[model samples]
Target: MKLENKKVVVTGSEGFIGSHLVEALIVQGAEVTALVQYNSFNSWGWIDSLEPTVKNSIRVVSGDIREYDNIKKIIKGNDVVFHLAALIAIPYSYQSPMSYIRTNVEGTANVLEASRELNVEKVIHTSTSETYGSALYVPIDEKHPLQGQSPYSASKIGADMLAQSYHLSYELPVATLRPFNTYGPRQSSRAVIPTIISQISSGKKIIDLGDVTPTRDFSYVKDTVNAFLKVAESDLSIGKIMNAGSGKEISIGQLFYTICKLMGANVELNIEQQRIRPANSEVNRLLADNRYLKEVTGWESRYSLEDGLIETIRWIDKNINHYKPNIYNV
Candidate 1:
């Protein structure tokens, strides 16, 4: 299952984590096709920021994931398919649940059906920590019951179930990789890490945030991408659901404080009602149990939380204009 000389298609290569995964596959000597969302402007999202050398190496395919014809065409003849495309903003999901279902669940179905029809060697389906909602126990495992507290999470849960059913009913060579709170460069401002960094770098004395008591297990984007590569390269991961995380929990308040310290910014907390999730929809905590991933693929977190946060802060500082700190990004 060595990736060298293999043909790999990444469905969301224009996204934060997907772009990183595409770069990793290219580094591993794989022939990479980057599937970017189609636009009239032909924007490649985060992939456009890649170095010329790296960007030139990838084949960019622009199409909608929800279109079965487009998916089948792009999936043809590829040895591995990494399905990372989805609508991920939680707040946006509240505003438009149907969009999430179409993109996350139905889009995933398109990938699975295409892979099954094309007989692709491997399919790596992306899952999220949000699928677990608030942890009923410390260090949630793959077997933990899924509780979708938000429309986004619910959509992802449906996607994961679809992947599982494909593996069981059709014998699709699919693996699900659930990542918890991945953060690094190229992440959008909707995420907490980018939100905090953008606001602090804007010279704002008061950081507007929602409930800070919820905790999450954060992993660096590079580490998460590496784990995806490992899962793709390992036959043992077939029909498995694995987690990529640091296995350490940090509350939002604590995380904000750490980021401020790293950026040398003195900021006070300003609880904004608009920034908060609906009371019933908020996930109180998420801590990953990555034991199965370690046992199956020998993948583990490579970066410490502090190191990753510092790197993220530095990236945001340089790319401040890409973010609008004054407005709450839904």
Candidate 2:
């Protein structure tokens, strides 16, 4: 299961975690093929942010994950496929659930089926904490009942099931990485960390946000990416689903104040109606029991919340122009 000199295909290689994963793979001396969403301009998405040497080392292909034939073609000769391409905005899912179904559920099926046929050595499927909606108990584990509170979560649940079924029914060499609120540089503004940092750095005194009572266990992107490599290298991870997080939870209000303290900005909270999820659909708390990730891959959270937040703020400060502070990113 050594990654050195192995051929790896990373779907959604243009995204926050995906781009970081691609870079990490290059560091492991893997021959990388990065699959970004197709565009006329031939944009590489966040892969464009990679160091020239790392970017040049990877073979970039622009293709939609929803296309089965396209996925099969790109994945045929790949030894490993890290499937991450998806429509992730929760609010946007409310507006367009079908798109989520197509990209998340069907796209995952494409990855699993194609990987099975090609006999790829590994398939790293991405899952989310949202599938466990509002934590039934503190420090949620892999055994928790999945509750699809939103279309986004529902779509992910379907995708996760497909990945697991592939392993059980067909013995596909697949592992699922379930992350709790991964935040860092290059994360989209639709995410909470970036939203807070962008708004504060933009000098907005009144911060418009959704429900602040919900707590999240945040994992730094670097730590999460490292875990992906660990999972890929371990035979113990095959046919298993694991969690990644700091094992600590923070309320959104607390997170906001922490960011403000670091940025030295005094801000008032203005809860916006449009930004809030339906009351019934909102996940009030999320805390990860990340023991399984440790058991399988010897992974643990490497960055403290404040340390990660500070780094994120520094990144957002430099990339402030990319965000529209007053608008709801969804």
Candidate 3:
């Protein structure tokens, strides 16, 4: 479906990916409504950093996704709903599992229920590769068994199940996009790429990180956003779960060295004990089989790891003040 002039509502509009998706949707000439998490400071998160014209293009709504009434009110009259809001920090999930369950699971139910009642045409539910846990084989496909090794992943798994149920039971036009490690500008410091870049940019010679041996299929943020768009635009994507990734995999240690090389910095690596996940909780490998997504939407990743890293480094360097590199974000 053409997005031009279609009414679109993005649930986590203040977040990194959501902000980018909002901007892209605006570029596509979609009338946008952004639902930012309500805060006392009236902060719009990354949306606050958008250019003046871009910020003015959308109607901004301050509300919580966990509230069904609030979500229903916001979702009314929109052609599509992009549900991206959730409590996503895995480390913090260990400290507060209930928060993850309430926000991720219940918040998604609110979106789905609201969309169903309002008869929204489409809903793109955001998902994570973490739900797959450690890949039992290379190039994990959509059929790969989901293993919830962490509370965060478990909450996402529950959310995914809810989306599937909505699609099957209510025939809601919902599609789940499971994106791999999406790294780029404006990502939170809780993520590894931002964590590493912020520390290195802060003039830290020794970079502190968790297990570097775990391999991940890192899709650039731009590519991931494109996948969202493609999925929403295609009728074939409804009632489907697809993987959006680069199909290539890299170990965190190798990625670190590559970033160091790209930045022209010789940095020592320090594996912080506090940074590592519990033995069984850590996902050792992930690679994506993006054939289904490709077949359905004709989408593929556009950026290489080095190219994406260069862009990320440049953005993080200029916005260094936004990061507290000295503290572990979790």
Put down candidate 1 lDDT per residue, 1-330, tens digits, no spaces. Answer: 999999999998999999999888888999999999999998999899998989999999999999999899999989999999999999999999999999999999999999999999999999999999999997999989999899999999999999999999999999999999999998998999999999989889999999999998999999999899889989999999998888999999999998888888877999999989999999998999999999999997889998988888888889999999999899
TM-score ranking, best first: 3, 1, 2
Q: Which lDDT tens digits does candidate 2 get at residues 1-330?
A: 899999999999999999999999999999999999999998999999789999999999989889999889999888998888899999999999999999999999998998999899999999999999988888899999999999999999999999999999998989999998999999988999999889888998898888899899999999999989999999999989999988999999999999889989978989898889998999999999999999999986789989998899998899888788877889
Per-candidate TM vs. native? 0.99, 0.99, 0.99
**lDDT for model 1:** 0.94
Residue-by-residue lDDT tens digits, candidate 3, 13-91: 9998999999999999999999999999999998999999999998999999999998899999999999999998899
Q: Rank by lDDT, highest first.
A: 3, 1, 2
Candidate 2 local lDDT, residue 163: 94
lDDT score of residue 125 within candidate 1: 97
What 10-residue stretch in candidate 2 is worst by lDDT?
320-329
> Relative to the true structure, how large is the alpha-carbon lDDT of every model?
0.94, 0.92, 0.95
